[model samples]
Target: MRFGILVNEGPFNHQASDSAYKFTEAVLRKGHEVYRVFFYYDGVNNANKLSEPPSDDRHIVKRWSELAKAHNLDLVVCVAAALRRGMKDELLAEGFRISGLGQLIEAGIQSDRLVMFGD
Candidate 1:
């Protein structure tokens, strides 16, 4: 099955992002496919390249980036939400892109299931 994930919370402030990541990883491990991951609201912070978590803590941004790279995942941050959260094109993580809600809608239509994780 193909899954579309939507995250609406930021890293650290809540566990929503972590849950989304773990769910995506588990889906892939079970041989399912992730169509895309759309980050909205504060979740756009997950795609911020400038995020610097402590060395001992989980690097949420980097973890998402690496997951996208390893699985060839489509990681998208809502342009409107990202801007509101101060995430710019210049600060996008390596595997993340700024896009419109149309992408999320497309993912919902294309994937077998759409799973949303948030506060």
Candidate 2:
């Protein structure tokens, strides 16, 4: 099945981002397509290139980037939400792009299922 993922929470602040990532990974492993992964609200933080978690912690941002690269995934951060949180194109991690809500809408239209994580 084709899937669209929407994440509304920060990577470290909540488990939503982790859950979304795991779901995406599992779907890919199952040979399903992910139309897009839309990061909105605090979830936009997942694209922050400057995020520096402790060495012991899993690097969520890097994981997302690598996953996108491996699967040719579209990892999109909501432009409005990102701007509000001081995230710009240059600040985005590799494999992530800043786009508008239209991308999310397009994902919903194109994918068979729209899976959302977080509130």
User: Which 10-residue span in candidate 2 carries the lowest summed lDDT?
Assistant: 83-92
What TM-score would you give candidate 2 relative to the actual structure? 0.98
Q: Residue by residue across 1-119, what tens digits does model 1's lDDT show?
A: 99999999999999999999999999999999999999998999888788898899999999999999999999999999988878999999899999999999999999999999995
Instruction: Write out the backbone clash pairs for model 2.
Output: none
Clashes of each: 0, 0
lDDT (C-alpha) at residue 112 in model 1 = 92
lDDT of each: 0.94, 0.96
Q: What is the lDDT of candidate 1?
A: 0.94
Q: Estimate TM-scores for all models.
A: 0.97, 0.98
Q: How high a TM-score does candidate 1 get?
A: 0.97
Residue 117 in model 1: lDDT = 98
Q: Which stretches of candidate 2 lie over 4 Å from their true place?
A: none
- Model 2 agreement with the true structure over 1-119: per-residue lDDT tens digits: 99999999998889999999999999999999999999999999999889899999999999999999999999999999999999999999999999999999999999999999999
Cα error, candidate 2, residue 1 (Å): 0.5
